[model samples]
Target chain A: MKKLINSADTILEESLDGFAAAHADILLLGAERKFVRRRTLKPGKVALISGGGSGHEPLHAGFVGLGMLDAACPGQVFTSPTPDQMIEAAEAVDTGAGVLFIVKNYEGDVMNFTMAAEMAGREVASVVTNDDVAVEKSTYTTGRRGVAGTLIVEKMVGAAAETGLPLAALTALGEEVNRRTRSMGVALLPCTVPAAGRPNFALADNEMEMGVGIHGEPGRRRVPLASADAIAAELLDAILKDLAPGKGSEVLLLVNGFGATPLIELYLMVNAAKRILDSAGVAVVRFLTGSYVTSLDMAGVSITVSVLDSKSTKLWDAPVQTAALRWGV
Target chain B: MKKLINSADTILEESLDGFAAAHADILLLGAERKFVRRRTLKPGKVALISGGGSGHEPLHAGFVGLGMLDAACPGQVFTSPTPDQMIEAAEAVDTGAGVLFIVKNYEGDVMNFTMAAEMAGREVASVVTNDDVAVEKSTYTTGRRGVAGTLIVEKMVGAAAETGLPLAALTALGEEVNRRTRSMGVALLPCTVPAAGRPNFALADNEMEMGVGIHGEPGRRRVPLASADAIAAELLDAILKDLAPGKGSEVLLLVNGFGATPLIELYLMVNAAKRILDSAGVAVVRFLTGSYVTSLDMAGVSITVSVLDSKSTKLWDAPVQTAALRWGV
Candidate 1:
C-alpha cells in the first residue's frame, strides 16, 4: 500500500501514542490505552463520549476537549472497540452529572456500546446516529450509515452539554440534531487499510462510487466520473430530499473531505454546493469546509446538511476547543 | 485526474469564491479577486502580505486573518503571482504602518515580490524564506527552496506584527525565524495539476523521492520505500544537522502532510519525529502537525524544526485564528 507506517499491527497503538503526545495539552490517554479523555474534567457537567472504527480520524478522538467530546474510544482500523474501552472511558470522564454516548449506527459499535452502558455502574444514555441518507442498509450498518453528519451532532450537542445539561437532555438534543442532519459521499479513489496492504476497492479512471460509506462500503451506485457541479447536485439532491427543509430554511453546509481531497477542491465543492442550495431556496446560514471526518486515504468528498434552529445555530457558533475544530476559545 | 473540480480553467476562481463565501466572517475577496484580505483590518498594525503559486491551498490565503497575514495573493497553480497583484494587495491593506512581504525563495516569486515592493509607493520591507535544507540550489530556487517552514515564519512574525512592530522589526524577526528553521520532505506519489491531468512525476511502486520540494522538484534521491521511523530519522538528521541546535534546545516540530496524506499518518510521523528529537536531547516545546503547506494532491510529508527562544516561543503560542490553524482566539 506504500503507507507511512512502521507495521500494520502497530498502526493503532503508534497512532494513538502520537495523538496523545501531540495533544497532551488537551487530551489524556486512559488506562490500557483504551480511550482518550479530556485532561481536565468539568465537574458536574454531562460527559459526552463517542467512538467507532479508527480509520475515520479526527472524528471521535480529535473532538475530545473543552466544548466537544469528553472522551473517545478508538478501535483498530474499521473495527469496533471492546465494551471495556467504553466502560473505562465512562468511568474516567463521567462526573456526577452522568454520561451520554454518541454511537454511530454500525452493528459492532452499537452492540459494544450498548453492552458497555449496561455494565457500567452509572447514569448513562445513548444517541444512535444514522444520518447518512446514502443507503438504507450497508455492509456494516443495519440502517443508513452514520457519516459526516455525526460531526454536526457532536458539535451542537457538545455545546449544549457544556452548559451543564442533564444526561437525558443531552441525549435528546443529540438525537434531535441527528434527525435534522443528512449526509452523502462520493469516492474517487479507494483507501487502503495499513494491514490490508491493498485498496479496499478499485475504480476505473473515469468511474466513481457515489453515496459511499465511511468504511468504503458499497454505496448507492457506481457511475462515470462527472463534473464538480453535477456531483454536488447529486449529493445535495439526495440529502435535501431526505432532510426536506422548507423553502427559506436555514442550514449549515459542510463539505467534508474523505482524507485525500485537498482543501482547494473541497472549497470548490463548497462553491458548487452553495450554488445548488441557493437555487433550491435553502439559505446556508453557516458553512464548514474541511476534512473533519475522513476515511484513511480515500479520495472523495461528503456533503452534510443540517437544518439549523435558533438554538442549534447558537450552539453551532458556540466556542469549541479541540484538536481538529477550534474557535473562540 | 479525478479531482473534484469543475474545470482546470475555473478552478482558481471557483475555489476562491468558495473560500470567500465559507470564511466570510474572517476574510474578504479583493477587487478582481487578486488577493484575500482580512475582513476587519487593524488600522495601525503592520500589514503582513504573502503570495505564491495557488496549489499550496492554505499556506497564503488560509493564513490570512487575526494574528497572521493581512493579505494573500494566489497565483495560477504552480505559477508565480503577478507584481500587479501584490501592488494591489498592498494598496488595499497597507495602513500608515507600512507592509512587509513574506516571499518564498522561488525565482518568479522573489522577482515579482521585489518588483512589487519597489513600485508599491509605500514603506515596505521583505523577508525571503529559504528554509528547505534539501538542496543548496534547485530547479526553481537559487538557494534553498522555501517549504513548510514558511508557516512557522508567518506565525511567529504574525504575532510580532500584531504587537505593533514596525515593518523593519517584523522583517528582522521574520528573517531570524527563517534562519532558525530547516525542513525536508519525502514523496511517495507525485501529485497532478488539474490542468496537466496527469501525475507530475512517476516513482516505482516500491520507491520514494526523499528531500522533495513542495512543487515536485527533484530531491536528494529516490530510494526504496522505507518505514516511517527510518524516513523520519533521515529527514530529522538533515534538519538537525543544518539547524545545529545544541543539546537541551527547545524547538517547534512541525510534521506537514503533502495534501493526500491522512491525519493518522501525519500524527504517526509526529510520534516518530518526537522520538528522534527526544533521543537527540532536543525538547519539542510546541507541535503543529497537519497538511498546512501542501503540493496539490501529493502523498508525502515534510518535517520542519524551528529553534525557539523565550520570545519566539511566546510568539508561537500567541493567538492565531485562520482557517487552517486556529487556537486561543
Candidate 2:
C-alpha cells in the first residue's frame, strides 16, 4: 500500500508523538506513551476515559479535553490496548470523584477495560457502547458493534460528567446516550492497514458494502453502487426502524465519513438523509457532518441518529473543547 | 467512480443545501443560492469575501462566520465562480467599512474577482494569494499557484478584518500574510471528478506526484513512492528555501490533507515536518493540521509554513469561529 507512513511497526507511536506535539496545549502523553490525558484536570469531576484500536482516529484521543474524555488509551492499529495501559490511564486522570470507562462493545476492548477496572484501585464503572445497528455479531464484536454513535455517547456523557456528576451517574448517562443512538455505514472502498500492506477487503468498482463496521468488517450485504439518495434511504431506513422514534421526535443527525469520503460528499449525504428524515416525520434538532470517526482510508459514510430529550439536547449543545468537536466555549 | 453523490449536476447544490442546513446558526444562503453569508453580520466591520472552485470545500464557504469571511461563493467543482456570484456576494456582505476579496491566484478566480471588485459599487480591495512554490506557471495559474497557504491568509487577515480594519489595511495584511507563507503538496493517488467519472491523472502503483497542486495538477516531478520522512524533507526543503525565514523565527506549521489521506498520516507528516523545522532552528509556535483545503478525494498532503511576526502571530491566535477552524473563541 502506498501509505504515508515510515513503517507499519512504528506508525502508531509516530502518530501518537505527532498528536501529542500538535495538541500539546490540550493533552499530555502518559509515561511510556500508554495513554493521553488532558493537560488540565478539573478536580473532583468524574474522569471519563475511553479507547479502542488506533485506526479510528479523533475517536477516543481526539475527544480528550475540557468537556470530553479525560484520558484515552490507544492501542496499535485495530488492536486492543492492554489492561495495564487502561489502569495506568485511570491512575493518572481519575480525580477523587472516580472514573468512568467508556468502552466500545468489542470483545478485546471490553475484556481489557473490564480487567483494568477490576485491577485499578478506585471507584470505577464502565459503559459499553453498541450503537451500530448494522450487525448483531461481527468479526470483532458480539451484538451490535459500536460505531460513529460512540462519538455521540462520549460527547453527551462527557458534558454531563463535566457537571461533576458521580461515576455511577455518569455511567448511566453514557449508557442512556448509547441507548438513544443508532448508526449504520456503507463502504465504497476498502482501507489498508499499513501492517497488512493490502486492503482489508476488495470490492468491484460498481459495488459497495452496506452497514460496514468501523474496522472494515463484513456488513449486512454488498450491493451495487447506488446514488446518494438511494444509499441514504437504505441506511436511514434501517436506523429509523431500529430507533422507532415518535412521529415528531427530535433528534441529532450525524453524517460521519469513513476516512476517505470528502466533506462535499458527506454533506450531500447529509442532505439526502435529512430529506429522508423529513419524510419520516422525524424532526432533526441538530446536525453534525464530518469525518469525526474514521477507519484508516476507507471511503464510506455512516449515519448516526440520537433521539434527544431536553437534558440530552442541552448536553449536546453544551460547550465542548475537544480537538475534533468544538463549539460554544 | 464510486462516490456518495447523486449526480454531477446536482452535487454542488445538494452539498450547499446540506451545508446551509447544517450551519444555519452561523451562515445564511444568498438568493438564487449564489453565495453563503454570515447569519449575523457586524454592521460596520470590514467584510471579508472569498470564493473559488467548490471541490476544495471548507475553503471559501466553511470559512464564513464570525472572525472570518463575511461571505463565500462556491463555484462548480474545480471551476471558478462567475463574476455575478462575486458581485452579489460583495453586495450582500459589504458594510460601511467595505469588502476585501481574498482571491487565490488562479487565472479564472483572479480575473473574476477583479471584475467583481471593479463592478462593485461599494469600496473594495483585493489580496491575491500565490503561495505555492511548486511551479512558476501551471495549468490554471501564472506565477506560483496559490494552494493551502490561502487558508492561512484568510485566517490571519480575517482576524484583522474582525477588528474593523479598513479594506485597504485588510488587503495589505492579507498580502503580507501571503508573502510570509509557502506551501507544497504531494499526491499518492488521483481523485475523480463526478462529471469526469475517471481519475484526473494516473500513476503506477509505486509512483507519486511530489509538489502537487490541490487540483491534482502535475507537480515538481513524479518519483518512486517514498517514506513519509523522505517526502516531508523534500517538501519542506522547497518551502523553507522559498520562505527563507531567519533562524529562530516562529512559524505556524499547517499539515493539510488532500481529502483521502487519514489524520494519522497527516499527524505523522507533522512530526516529520516538525523535526525538519527544529533542525533548521525554526520554532513552530502554532500548529494546524487537517483536511482544511482539499482536492475531491486525492490521497496526499500539503505542508504550509507561515513565518509569523508579532502582529500576524497575534492575529493568527485571534478568535475564529469558522465551521472548519475554531479555537480560543
Interface RMSD of each: 0.7, 0.8
| Residue ranges of candidate 1 with Cα displaced over 4 Å | none
lDDT of 1 by residue, A116-230 (tens): 9999999889999999999999999898888888989899989998898888888889999999999999999999998889999999999999999998998999999999999
Off by over 4 Å in 2: none
Pairs with backbone N, CA or C atoms under 3 Å apart (clashes), candidate 2: none
Q: Write the per-residue lDDT of candidate 1 for residues B136-190, one digit (tens) a residue.
A: 9999999999999999999999999999988888989999999999999999999
Model 2 C-alpha lDDT per residue in residues B1-329, reported as the tens digit of each score: 98999888999999999999998988999988899999999989998899999899878799998888899999999999998998998888877888889999999999999998898887888899999999999999988899899989998888887787877788788888999999999999999998999999999999999988889999999999999999999999999999999999999999999899899899899899999999999999899989999999999999999999899989988988877887776
Q: How many steric clashes between backbone atoms does each model show?
A: 0, 0
TM-score of chain B of each: 0.99, 0.99
Docking class of 1: high
Q: Rate the local accuracy (lDDT) of all candidates.
A: 0.93, 0.92
Model 2 compared with the native: what TM-score?
A: 0.99
Summed over model 2, clashes come to: 0
Tens digits of lDDT, candidate 2, A206-242 = 9999989999999999999999999999999999999
